[model samples]
Target: MISVRVNGQRFQVRAASIVIHDGHVLLHRAADDDYWSLPGGRVEIGEAASATVVREMKEELGEAVTCGPLVHVVENFFDIKGEPNHEIGFYFQVALSEGSPLVDKARSYSGLESDLRLMFQWHALLDLGSIDLRPAFLRNTLSTIPLVFSHVVHPGADDV
Candidate 1:
């Protein structure tokens, strides 16, 4: 909701959740997207990043989650629809609250955001390299969560 365009490029601050169970990690993607990413949303004005993660999970999954420690802070630059964009992302550890049905769901499912449908799934940590998970660095970071917080910068296509 805090997205803005500056100098013809989009800028946003996003908060994402890292939810892992068994050997799989939870991820979601818009129906039209070819890649999957963490299940969180833009950081709204006046809301803490952690709070955004909690709020997003509820709104997207219809389930309450307990926000945990900050995991990673990423300055991610990328392109969307061929338009350059910049985003600062806060990745937080999270867990579904007790008695939430989604905790044990093994198969992929759909969640709704207004009229848009989002696909949610649990992917085996060992198989992340095969998926087009965004930020690219996450393919390795998610597999071995750092003991201390980490800050990462993912260069955009032009910078590569």
Candidate 2:
């Protein structure tokens, strides 16, 4: 039960990722790196939440995705050298209908036989729970807030 404290309130949220491919999530297992996480990074200065997602995906995956509504916001804290660090993460449901994904330069995962500089991989929906990830997905509520499931409401043929 790892948790974090935010502004004197204890919670846990350090990172976030939202990857959608063929109705499935895209997961990355770093070279020699354990734990499977979604493809995203930290939020930069003067960057909006929506923009951060776009930039992170481009930086890590090299794929451009159409971001939908804001999905999840998680608050977590970590202990760095006995010091507490705060991390508030936001994950969203995105549509990657454009460019192909690119892998970053590889470092640790050499034995996996991913010749690419960076390792590229995907995981099935069934395994999302078995993996150890910072932020979690495939849920209706996060951070105690109810997330509106946009995919649930599919329009008829007329809308298409």
Candidate 3:
């Protein structure tokens, strides 16, 4: 579920993914081959969202990403493992260094399939509208994005 201005208090929600590089946004195609999404997952117990982003990115893409302030937060509601639920996803600004990702001991950390075999790639921000996303989530996200921000954000939820 995305964040809402409930009585003016900013309650954080989900663990939204974000990674910007050369005007392109990193997207994740789950190993199960479901719908594509920004590279991220639910916030682990006791972990901060920003930290989660850093850890998740490092695990999924095989690179270290520098993250910035909270650019936007979307309320996400979806079916996970057959359960309907919601979360407030914080989209922090981030940057990726220039290079190809390599999975090797000398290059990075340890792990096997969960950290390696996943498929991720970049797509032009301007082309985001072509992606299929959760409708309610995207509409609310775009409507609230601060106009001054220009980082390549997702289409919020849907409309892409």
Pick by TM-score: which candidate is best?
1
TM-score of 2: 0.58
Sort order, TM-score high to low = 1, 3, 2
Q: Compose the digit string of candidate 2's lDDT tens values, residues 66-159.
A: 7777665654444434665555666676667555432222222221212423454555454556666543334223222334533221122243
Model 1 worst lDDT window (10 residues): 141-150
Q: On lDDT, who's better, 1 or 3?
A: 1
- Against the unseen true structure, what C-alpha lDDT does each candidate score? 0.89, 0.50, 0.55
Q: If the candidates were sorted by their lDDT against the true structure, best first, what order would they fall in?
A: 1, 3, 2
Instruction: Quote the lDDT for 124 in model 2.
Output: 49
How would you encode candidate 3's per-residue C-alpha lDDT over 49-158 as one tens digit per residue?
A: 88877777776656687777776566544545654444566677666655645322133222223544556666556556767644233423433334234333233456
- Give the winner by lDDT: 1
lDDT of 1 by residue, 1-160 (tens): 7899988999999999999887788999999999999999999999999999999998988888999999989989988998888899999999888776776656787899888899999998899999999888888988894435889889745674
RMSD for all candidates, in order, please.
1.8, 11.2, 8.2
The reply for model 1, stretches above 4 Å from the true place, is: 145-147, 156-160
Which residues of candidate 3, in runs, are more than 4 Å off?
Answer: 1-13, 80-82, 98-117, 134-160
Error of 2 at 119 (Å): 3.5
